[model samples]
Target: MELQKTSNGHHDLSPDRIPENGSPVTRFDALENITEGDTFLPNKSNGKIETQFTDFVGKTSFGMSIFNLSNAILGSGILGLAYAMANTGIILFVLLLTSMAILSAYSIHLLLKSAGVVGIRAYEQLGNRAFGRPGKILAASIITLNNIGAMSSYLFIVKIELPHIIQGLLPDNSDYWFVDGRYLIIIISVLVILPLALMKRLGYLGYTSGFSLSCMVFFLISVIYKKFVTECPEEHSYNKTVPTESIYNSTDGMCEAKLITINPQTAFTIPIIAFAFVCHPEVLPIYTELKNPSKKRMQKVANISILTMFVMYLVTAIFGYLTFYGNVKSELLEMYSKKDTLMLCVRLAVLIAVTLTVPVVLFPIRRAVLQLLFPDKPFHWVRHISIAVCLLFLVNLLVIFVPNIRDIFGFIGATSAPSLIFILPGIFYICIVPEEQEPLKSRPKIQAIAFVTLGFIFMIMSITFIIIEWVTGKKTSGGH
Candidate 1:
């Protein structure tokens, strides 16, 4: 791989070929190569298909694409969703979630439309083609920030939940450093995450990843089951530290939570929902992998993935919120006693899922950073290991210093997730399908403008809201 300098004196990250795969680079073509709106009428004569743009072939089926994409969309963020609901009450949370889901779907539409027009599928390449180096750099930077923040959240869960598991199983709980949360995070990172993170490809880690997904399901079931079966002890072990009971009222054998409330913390729902639907970076890769790639096929995959994740998130959140109500913590698992038999299974599964996920999330951040810093260089083992070590160290420091995962979610959700999910897609659509040639009443133009305007508002408000949150000392959650 060589960094090709464009005619206009800029570094082109979209290389023509990759020696490792002995094939053309993924999605490095210009939009002029394909006819507009004609989504992949592949030439399949005999058993062979023709792709003149590059020798690379896609073997992933449409259904498989949906599974892959849904896995991407559902990660550690689900843990904090109840926290989000608790922050913005049930009513406002639902409204924000619906709007964000719609925006996410439409953003994907714009991205696919633009990429389809140009036959480009890489996220950074799309930016380069639409705008230039600045655009490409910006795209890469946002990916790094959003992905790193996401990975941090995943590890932060490990930091919080793993300690509970360890203490529960351990015969010794007398302030040993081994059982401590801070040291345990580093130890887990070394013993478990490091090896998994070192895996060659995302496909190699599939079984563990799938198992982790199963754990999240168990977590949902545990919440729903425990809500009815288990009654809270008069004194929760951490009751003194976590004073959340006072926030809710018991009325008619149910917790009384408001449907809507507009406090400083309510604004956090924006970033939380924004981060929830953020799998945009993975969209292009999955699009390229579809057996007979087409924007329509990819759109189907995206829709299925989005709907599946939305259902999963909605049920998990509703159950978790209903169970904990006023006592809901940032991470839902923290709300439960470590000794509960049902929740222990949920804990082990989720802990496995989240710890395994650290590596999965780290892959994109490393890739994005490499694209930003070293586009010309091919994969080097030394560089890969070094980068992974550095990233894990940085994440460890963050997890230790930053006790709450929700804060990381809020910050990253506000800053980078919006740009990738909303703004860039709208901008790319405007560039590819120019309004200058379209009629004044063109629906696409109107929709694109509206999308951009909505994106701008989301971005601005998220930042402003977070700033206000920091100033008021209600940085992580609504309560404290």
Candidate 2:
């Protein structure tokens, strides 16, 4: 039997023959015996393998996994997804979705590789191991800032939709926008999100998958029914003529500069399009939940999630774009504002779904900030601070600069969108994993070529759009 040493430097009796005192013993000592019942007994000292395996299965499941995945993909940005697709044309939007999905899958694969080799769980941890403490700080900062922007945008949406919905119910009350309706709505939103935030672990909300998925499916069905069954006014025809010049136009030239403006190169740089498809980093936590956490299972989940998102976004974008045609606005609800009952119902459903789902997006940011500032403290207080801070910022933004939601989407896309979606994953993948542990080392030459090529492409496109927006002095008009 093997001997074991405790932290106090005491030699403990072997497990094969228990001491009369019944002290703890190590697994190596227990392994000396090969009895039938012994296989079922856990090692006296530690049960790392058993516990990890059980946790993996418990943590990973179709419902919760999908909810987390969808939570990451669906955010305030979805409000503008339909409009962005309409602007670019249906075919272009579909192509972009496809490409983005593939790229996102590739990025997740890289992340899984790094995580497996280094035993990293969080994105910040992976960043620290790969690029240094600075990398961790940068990665965490980007995610936090992006989430803040996303939450603020959500608040902006609630402020806009809630007041309008309430006023519609009470047409005589034009004062709904002023007489604490905004404040009430903000309070209601905070209350709804707070409970979800207060949960000590995401596992507690795992049951929410069915509700969230139902909301999503119902929302989609309503949109489809509204788009196909209801007949829009003749004015909504696709062939409708648009005014050549307007105050909204920033350029002096005619608005219709090109019939089919295909910037083969810049076509992929559309902000909202990129925003809709980039959600890889958010999927990192679920890797450990898988029963096996094998590379194959990871790839399957990644592929399935991406495909599902692509199909959902494609259908929604196409239908919304077709319904609005040239009159399309940035927010999908605008297209249904004056439409029949069915259309209005769909718009309201989608708004509710998005509002309810806001807290999931905010959770990650809260966790990241808590890890950074008070890593050693109980995470519950950190969650409280995060909720408070989020509510405060959201309320202030709603009061001060609740500009057009469309423009807010653009601003988020311009600033934090690219960094969160593309830059961070690519950098971490390349830098974090040791050379010996890299799974694709056999094809290092080809892998290097592809990595550099894709990395450079993403970097150049993201940087260029950000720079152009800064230089053009253009301000996005509020409310799509």
> Which candidate tops lDDT?
1
Best by TM-score: 1
- Cα-lDDT of candidate 1: 0.68
Question: How high a TM-score does candidate 1 get?
Answer: 0.80
TM for candidate 2 is 0.74
Give lDDT per model, in order.
0.68, 0.54
How many residue pairs clash per model? 1, 2
Per residue, candidate 2 scores C-alpha lDDT tens digits across 1-480 of 333331112222222223445444443223222221122234354635231211123346655666666656765455556655544555566677677777777777767665554443467666665565676677778777676666666566666676666556556677554435468555756577667756655545555544665666676676677677645445544323433222233432221222222322223326556667656545655664544455567667777767777777777766665555445555666656543555455555656665555565666676566546644444356556565566555644654455554444455545566566566665666665434444444464246446556655655665565456557753221211
Least accurate stretch of 10 residues (summed lDDT) in model 1?
A: 238-247
Residues 375-425 of candidate 1 have per-residue lDDT tens digits of 656567777788889999988888788666566656766768778887888
For residue 334, give model 2's deviation from the true position in Å.
0.7
Model 2: clashing residue pairs?
404-478, 404-479
Quote each prediction's TM-score: 0.80, 0.74
Cand. 2 Cα-lDDT = 0.54
**Candidate 2, 111: how far from true, in Å?**
1.4
